[model samples]
Target: MYISILCFGIFSCQDLNLEPKGMLGGPELFGNEYGVKKYFAAIYNALPIEDFLYYGTNSNNAYRPDNYWEAGKNSLGNMSGEFFNTWVQVDNDGFAYWPYDRIRDINVFIQSFPEYQVNYTAEVYNNLLGEAHFLRAFFYFGLAKRYGGVPIIKEAQDPLAPVETLEVPRNSEYDTWKFIYEDLTFAMENMSTDIDETGRANKYVAAALLSRTMLYAGSIAKYSQYLGFQGEAATSAGMAGIDASKADEFFQYCVDAGKVVETGPYALYTRGYPDKAKNFADLFLDAESSESIFIKSYDITAPGNNRLRHSYDALMCPQPDMSSFVGAESYPPLDFMELYDMPAIVNPDGTPVRFDHRGDIRNGMEPRARGTMYFDGDVLRGKAFDIQRGIYKNFDVLASDADQGSPNAPINNPNNRILGGRGWTTEINGTTLNITGAHGNFEDQGGENNGWGSAFIRKYVDPDRATSDVREYRSDQHWVVFRLGEIYLNTAEALYELGSRDEAFNYIEKIRERAGATITRPALDQSTSNIGTINKANYPYSIEKSLQFIRDERARELYGENHWWWDLRRWRTADQVLNQFRHRVLSSYYVADEGKYIYLDEINRINRSWTASKQCYYEPIPWGEIGKNRNLLPQNPLY
Candidate 1:
């Protein structure tokens, strides 16, 4: 009988040895409880799908909003088409892969997990199931946001079977949102209130994601209010159909989430060591900080996988100063930098006084260029001729030969650019102390004229990632998928949108308080102005003004943490903000050239890099995916 069973299995099943393992062996492998735990861990690894900044976002220290894009490149820098074409926009074509890859794993785990005979405490079982549900919802939420009507698959399926049953039609955005909300609600109820590692999502993290998802949906449902705004996006088609009124409901969710995290044991990173100068940037460098909610841990000792430090070193390092500057070509554009600038101070008489251009400093009003790079006596006199090379390129000449400077020992000497304690100064305790760039330092490279600009990215970079000036690899610093600060920002945005301006300001102020910024309340709070019912004066830039202000604060606070492009897109002015920076950077490169040197290739690259074409506004559906599931999905307009 056993022989007969085996012989019958050979004819009925594809592989006799692997048969009775439950349909393609899926059940056999996943039926074990231990396997289920490991599978869930993989899902957790995929939460933040991409590190959007390093490859494309910071090309010009502005927002590129596409892959194949670089800071000064004109054509989305399509050196490799994969990054430029698929990675840049939200295309349905590229959309089918990663989200489904994760979903399929989760679905398979769900199907296989039920059959396993494993003892469980209520808390442990609930948390495990809750985590799986949260991940499914999270993946779905991302897909829904990117591709509106995606197939909702909740069970494992036969790979050989026609994808028709599996090919289920696309669900409505509202329906998808409902699923996400339900899943997150389940997670909030079942998951542990506290997680040992900041990298894992707890109730608060789930709540934060819930708030973020709702905010995206609510905005899409309420885009009608700002239809009058001039731009390519003025038309309803440009927006993903977000409504302004949805702000109220969505922001309430954020506030609720914030309350959970606020009451829970999470704190902002406020500690510093004896080296006061290193405090602000240290949180990112350290692996174990109280404030890091979720982290992508790195081991420099590991092979083939690093984090963001390489990218940071490449961009932040200046040239020819032995300060680790490979190509100081991708600095922040003026428009983005200006956002971090404090608003003009006003007298009681209402006259506005421009604040002193003290420059960008960690603690004071100093130019960022000053502290970030140096070109002074020590550099020029001691090592100027020694440091000159093809890549370094005429360091003394570039620094001294500006339109007003001199090559000879006459007026406008290059000596002024030398940065050994004299090139740049940092203010500490009301004292201007000088810092030197001794052998491969980040600070003390020359500024603007010497290939230096105010543009810098600080989100990720590990000292251990690379040895040379060019940090062209991944960094090991953990990426914060969800941080406490974002919860505060989400709450503020939602409250403001919901006509709770006072409440919104309170939340916004809380973030500002954490960041150590001074706040001033509006005399007659205009929080109610943006709601549909109010007949208030539009105040000409008040909505945009406040919104932009908050956006900039988030950028400065978050910098290279990789959220600006998404925020700009959600706010529906990506084209405007990006184009402004593009033009400004192009003009700078041009102005610098009229005097002498030319980097025309760089110019062309930046000028023609990215466009807010309709396709970019909405990503195309993958051709393969549409074929598999024909009922529920269609390509987005333009793409």
Candidate 2:
């Protein structure tokens, strides 16, 4: 009675006649509602949702794949330069993520689910079918973003069929997006609005997916030509880039999807009330927050399932203090910190701004920045973060005198600038004072467990987990897949792109107000520039200054949420943005003579830089898959 399942891996040409060992029969597994849920569980587990457990490496572990303790160190943030780390660099050539096996499963479900209609109510039957479509759209989205025009295999192919019939040609980039749009549209229409299952897709969740995917498609249609790949075979074949004429069509789809989500029972989370920083931080931790549209739940109790638990807390916080395992592998670079409304580190006179306490740097900063990163005095697990770079014995010169912590700077000489490893001290006037703080900037230490930058990522780190329990694979914080805040940003960006500038700012203003930004709304500036101010990236296309501001707001709000890398790719600016992009650090120095603290901008001690080639925009359709099906040629541009 057991059904034989043919396991496939991205169009593998190998034909092996093997026996099915442990198979679940369709009659027993897909005949009823509970059985259908059970059947869908395996498909859900293989989703390409990049969450905390995602490992950004040149392996198969890119999509929600688990490497346990190393996941945090190999996170997309580290690879994307969103969070500075010594371990990982820009994985320019992606990890060849092909999820045809999962796609096949969804296809099977879609084709076979109708047979079970006799066992359920009409609503339940339609809902399950709609859910299947939603899952397929998600898989397609993962593929379309990475490979452009992938082969759209809607029906489950019979392995026993003729080879010619089984081999499907690749679809055009526009058609691929249109297919996803259609699938999501059907899902939104047929899926019930009342289903409350956690982590399961409902009608609103389908709309969120539509909103995200269409936004991506719109961006590609509008910006892909800027990459100048028109002469390439893939571009000419309409496989790698979408036509600019189709931009408005996809943008309008995104706008419509956003409107659909707005009709759902979702709102921006604001439970923490007056303390906007705490409110922003709590939004991620609160599983029941109204802002969360769709979440991928994790459970620490699921011991055997590595994807169910993550090591975020252990690898993000300093060891023996904030974590019980290897401490703090990643730190927030000062380049990103300055994006928020920050207190000036240097005065008009060009000297470092002296502060009464080291924590004064947080005084005028945006609440969202504080919420996203842990500062010097920020407390976690009842212990305050003690982060100081070093002390200046007699610093009485312009901040530039240090020359971005240059070794040849006269003021930076070892005799004057005191720096040390963890717990190292100096004797000044018979009083021994610790040179560096307990948490970081250990001059003699490597970047592995030492804090390289000024702050630690605080967005998804579980504050409630005790230090004793913060070991490898012991943390369980749900990854917010689709949230109302992100939806708002998506809507705003699409609105702006569609020429509805005033309506776009309405959403931006709401997000900034919640983040406690000093300027809730800034006047629009239509001045166009090809070079961005943030990274000074020389983009191929000119963009409005106001548009860049909107993009920056997305970064500020969604920091460490695995969106920056994708954002850069879709904007066709990855290569320019990451061109020898060296991260900067904010070093806290205590002036010995003045007895005050000063924060100075300095290059990361290791001087590590991130670089992405044009090839990064679209990962080459995995060579193996191309070998199996020649139709996947002429591989992605600049492969």
Specify the highest-TM-score model's number.
Answer: 2
* Residue-by-residue lDDT tens digits, candidate 1, 24-46: 34333344546555555656655
Per-residue lDDT of 1-639 in model 2, one digit per residue for the tens? 011142242123123333344444455566888878877787887788878878876767676555557888888889999989898999878888888878877787787677777988989899999999999999999999988998999888898998877767889999999999999999999999984799999999999999999999999999998888999999999999999999999999999999999999998888998999999999999988999998999898886655788888888889888899888899898878999988899999999998998888999898999899999899999999988888889888999999998878999999989999999999877878789889869978787678786788899888989999988888888999999888999999999999999899999998998899965455788889898755678988999988998999999999999999999999999999899999889999888888899998999988899999998988888888877888778888887
Off by over 4 Å in 1: 1-34, 52-98, 160-163, 224-247, 273-277, 305-312, 319-329, 342-452, 462-474, 524-548, 579-610
**TM-score for all models, in order of appearance:** 0.67, 0.96
Worst 10 residues of 1 by lDDT: 385-394
Model 2 alpha-carbon drift over 4 Å, by segment: 1-23, 64-66
- Model 2 / residue 309 / CA error / Å: 1.0
The lDDT of model 2 is: 0.87
Measured over all alpha carbons after superposition, the RMSD of each candidate to the real structure, in angstroms, is 10.5, 3.1
